[model samples]
Target: MKTADIQPFFATLKAANPSPQTELEYTSVFELLAAVLLSAQATDVGVNKATRKLFPVANTPQAILALGLESLEGYIKTIGLFRSKAKHLMETCRILVERHDGQVPDTREALEALPGVGRKTANVVLNVAFGQPTMAVDTHIFRVSNRTGLAPGKNPLEVEKQLMRRVPGDYAVDSHHWLILLGRYVCQARKPRCWECLVSSYCDYSPKTPPPQGSLR
Candidate 1:
């Protein structure tokens, strides 16, 4: 996709939902950070289900630290890597309390310095929590970036850089969520639903799938 095409594409997305929010439910920055950390290799549905219970009891870094890793595991065991995630969560909380005064850090470097928080997680925190225009390339975004000729790259970091360079400023803030949801629901890995995709016309995927014959939604 050309630089010119990017603006209208995001305009359509924003028009559909003016204030698109992260599917992972959280009431505070700390909760959002912890939920995103646990979301690796997990689904939003599962993360939300777990956090709905966890957040009520411990919504801050210091509070979660006091919850202890064993108790934390009980709540998030349904998620994959619960043991490691629990440990990371506790350690991150400790770092937050000791270094950042129990608040979720706003800077990428500071956020990344916390356990379980990397570039992807930090990008999400900055964008969703702080309303910055950073884009975090997850599997879905990576696939969409390449499949749509929007920002093709072999690695997530490279793709992220391309997207940052190419995406229009007006849409950059919410493009992360738009691209992720588009790939998760429409541009699926097994069988992309190209037939009903809103951005199918702009996509560069070859031999796009057509809607079933005589079928209407």
Candidate 2:
């Protein structure tokens, strides 16, 4: 997209949501970390549902560590790959307690060192928990970036780098949330709701999907 169009694209998003936040529910950094870890291959709503029951019992790393693998699995078994996620969480808690004093690390390197925490998860923690201007290009962000030509790339890393370089500095901090929300609710993968999209004029997607039959324009 052109530089002129880019500014308005983000401006529209900013005007729509002055302050955006992750859908995942968590009270502390530790809970946020745990929630993100469990969110892999699962919906935020699903992860939130599991964490709702899990956090009250054990929000801290040490507390979660004490839950043991079997008990922990019981709490998150509703989520896909619960067994593996439980194991990674168990090991991650152990590393946190032993290394960083049980606090979620703010640095990408230390955060990614955890078993279940990859670059994307690390980026999320850094951005949401530490208030860093990092772009964690999940499926939603990836789709929106490419579809809108805001930062098209073949993969998440490429798209992420492009976003960091292309996104206006003023909007960088919240761009991640905005793009994700746009893709999840508006520019969906199957059928984008271009008719009511706030930034549809700036999008590069061709043949924008019209409103459904019998729906008001």
Candidate 3:
């Protein structure tokens, strides 16, 4: 997309959903961090399903550690890579309790130091929990950025850099959420629902797909 179209593109998204939020359900910063950690290759729905059950039982770092590794694994066993994710969560909880007094760290350096927390996970926590303008380039964001010519790049890090530099300041903090939602629901990977896309006019993709037969606009 052109530099000029960027403003209206995000403006439209904001108008449609003024306050976008992560699909992952969490009541606290630690819960958000844990949910993101468990969501590596899992869907938000799956993560939420597990967290809904787990958080009430063990929401805090100390509480999670008290649950023991086996119980933690049992709670999240439905998710993909549960064993490894549970181990990472256990290790991360230990670090949080021992080093940070059981509180979720705000700095990127501190957040990334946890065993399961990568740049992407750190970005999610920083953006959603701390209101930072960091972009967490997940599969949806990556696909939307490349497909719309908004911030095309070869990798997540490259795409993240592009978005940080290109997105307007007013929209930066929430742009990742908007893009993720757009990609998840409209600009889909297998076949984009261009016919119903609200911002398709500003998208760089050509030959937009038509509505399916008998489907109403």
Supply every candidate's count of residue pairs whose N, Cα or C atoms clash at under 3 angstroms: 0, 0, 0
Q: Each model's TM-score, in the order given?
A: 0.96, 0.98, 0.99
Alpha carbon deviation, residue 209, candidate 1 (Å): 0.6
Q: Give per-residue lDDT, candidate 2, residue 196.
A: 82
Candidate 2, poorest ten consecutive residues by summed lDDT? 61-70
Error of 3 at 180 (Å): 0.6
Tens-place lDDT digits, model 2, residues 12-37 = 99999999999999999999999999
C-alpha displacement of 101 in model 1, angstroms? 1.1
- Which is superior by lDDT, 1 or 3? 3
Clashing pairs in 3: none
What are the per-residue Cα lDDT tens digits for candidate 3 across 28-104?
99999999999999999999999999999999999999999999999999999999999999999999999999999
Which pairs of residues have clashing backbones in candidate 2? none
Which one wins by lDDT: 1 or 2?
Answer: 2
lDDT of 1 by residue, 55-99 (tens): 989888888888998999999999999999999999999998998
Error of 2 at 204 (Å): 0.7
Rank the candidate models, highest TM-score first: 3, 2, 1
Task: Identify the superior model by TM-score, candidate 1 or candidate 2.
Answer: 2
- For each of the candidates, the C-alpha root-mean-square deviation to the true structure, in angstroms, is 1.1, 0.7, 0.5
Better of 1 and 3 by TM-score: 3
Q: At residue 4, what lDDT does model 3 achieve?
A: 98
